[model samples]
Target: MTDGLTLRLKYLCGRYWRLLVPVLVLLSAIAFAGAAAGVTSDAQPQQTTVETDSMTVETTLSTEATVTGNTTLYEQNDTLTNLPVYLRSATPEVRLIAVTTTPPDRTVSVTQQIVLRLSATRNGEVFWRDSRVLAADSTNVTNGSTQTTATLDVQQLARERLAEVRAETGNVGTVRVEVETIAVYQTDAYSGRTSAATPVRVTERAYELETPQRDQQTNVTTEQQTAAGGAGGAGPLSVSNGPALRDLGAGLGGFVALGLAALVWLTSRRIGDFDTFRQRYERVRYAEWISRGSVPATGRHARVPVETLVDLVDIAIDSEKRVIYDVSKGVYAVVDENLMYEFRENNDGDMNEFGFVPITEPTESGSTEKTSSDDGAETAAAADSWFDADTEPPDHDSDASPDDGS
Candidate 1:
């Protein structure tokens, strides 16, 4: 059984050697890709983080006010402190604070300040603006210090600015009023590294020129970032994961397989089936004599089968007739008196031949007379008579004859 299988395999390889070429090339490419992937995955660099000492500075903003009124909602000496919705009557005091933390055995000198600004904008453009340095301080710290505070009386400042702007413009039509505070901190570390932080708060309130109106809204404008710097006073450290081994292998295999598939396709296109090439070559060579149509089945003539198209053409030339080729049936024929000489390409060894015996009848002279039962007999007789007459045959001997060409 092994010997028989070996022989069968050898026969297939010999018969289809062209197909094996691309298969071998693909296998080689896959091997090379796998090796390359293994090497690259081994040599790939790993990610790691380095540790060192660093410093950080943190800051916050707050508010303080005394609420005094005769109404039930407002009481005397009632303090309104910290975040939003502070009563505009309280004359809210805005405070800025900062703190610094450093590594062990390190000291940092800090300078902090709070700044206040009052502005009015018309059509989104600032028309009147004023700024004041509400408070400033300096300190040195090894760990962190208590609250570094600077205060601004925002309600009083906004009231004064509103009166001034209204008086200058005669009427405040759709003018937006705003009060803002900025807390800034600068730090100088022992290693000569310096850093700064600026956090902002904005306050908007409704008011008349002479009276503080409804409650105020305060918002922290800066996106809070808790940590400032990386270790060793560098920028923030980052680490990323590299490609996994299995993923690398799969990607390499896919790329090589795609390339090999393309190669196989090109090879198959360039080197086509030998028999199909012969058929196309014959068609092109004999295109002048060949017409695309169906040939009728012969029943009144003896069939004489030939091997190639050249034999059929030779027979047609000798008989002084044109060749009829049926593309659907893959047949070429030339009809002479009682004989139909046929030629067909044996592509799969199962092509049918025109082999029907002639139809005959007894005449009164006791002799056999061959005849056709279809109306095609009249057409054939007319065509034969026309060919025999002075009507010239087709110009079958043109310079593009298949005899001297492919």
Candidate 2:
């Protein structure tokens, strides 16, 4: 039985071996492929999930400043007539007192006089204005011996006087105060001018008129009557029985007519005179004149061709030595020697061109021997021949000699 079982097992294992081997091989291959795929993927650049961020920011700030102080700018006698002139008494009561100042400790000390100006106005017109000096009394102050306060009584008297003046005028106005202190000198003590010091603070005040209400009303009524009178026959536009208007109109009309006549006369005279002058002066001709030495025998009565004359003139011949016979002035002067030479040379070839060289004077025949016409003709003919030459390619070699170059 054992023998039979073993044989049977061996037979079964042999039969299934093919299928089992193939199954194991397939499993190994699958594992290897998966590993290879993973390695390849790792080797390739990774698509990293790199997160990017963006943000906005802002900021703000501020600051502050401050200042403070108390200082004495200027000080004057309090009793001075600070009141408006119109409010001050008419009688000159307030006199300037001595001015003085205490020596300053922490700050500087300055003493100045306050100037007051008094004026009166009537019917909107200033009839009077006067400058009054008010000084300070400095009896108590040491060092600064020129400072003092004005008396109260005097100030009161000034106010009273101003009040009286205002009451009488019935048209009180404001008083202007201008204060300026200059350097004080011992020599200027007696001079009417103010001594030097710091400038004083200027102040102004207006004094009301004391006219009664009834009087004001009456004045208004009078003003209205005057205005009404001015608006009527006596007004600026009112026509009087005189001939002023008629005369003005007549004069204006006469002025207009005279202007028109003068304009027409000027226009006609300008046109007529221009036409007459144009007829008399319009002519075309050349002029040549000679002065100084008499004309040369060869050049006497030698009429320069218009072409030659033009050439001579282009050379700037001296007017005094030039003779113009073509028009206006006839043989009036001698021809410029330089201009004559230029003309002769231009007509004839240069001296070097001819075998006969130039001499200071004309040839014995009194004429240039060098003839330019033949040379000019030859040059012109050569130019024409060159222009007419054919532009075709030559039949000979380009580098050939003259006989062959042609």
Error of 2 at 202 (Å): 22
Top lDDT hit: 1
* Candidate 1 similarity to native, TM-score: 0.42
- Model 2 misplaced stretches (Cα beyond 4 Å): 1-81, 86-146, 152-311, 314-342, 346-406
At residue 258, give the lDDT of candidate 1: 59
Query: How well does model 2 score by local distance difference test?
Result: 0.32
User: Per-residue CA lDDT of candidate 2, range 1-406, in tens?
Assistant: 4533433333333344445445544554554555444333333432333224211111111111111112132132223233333212322233333332223211222333434445666556777666655543212223433443222223343456545655665645643222223222221112112332211112122122211111000001111122321222232223551223333444455455445444444433433333222211111112222111223443444444333434444443545334322111111223454233222223223221111222223444566444456664664443233222212212222132323212
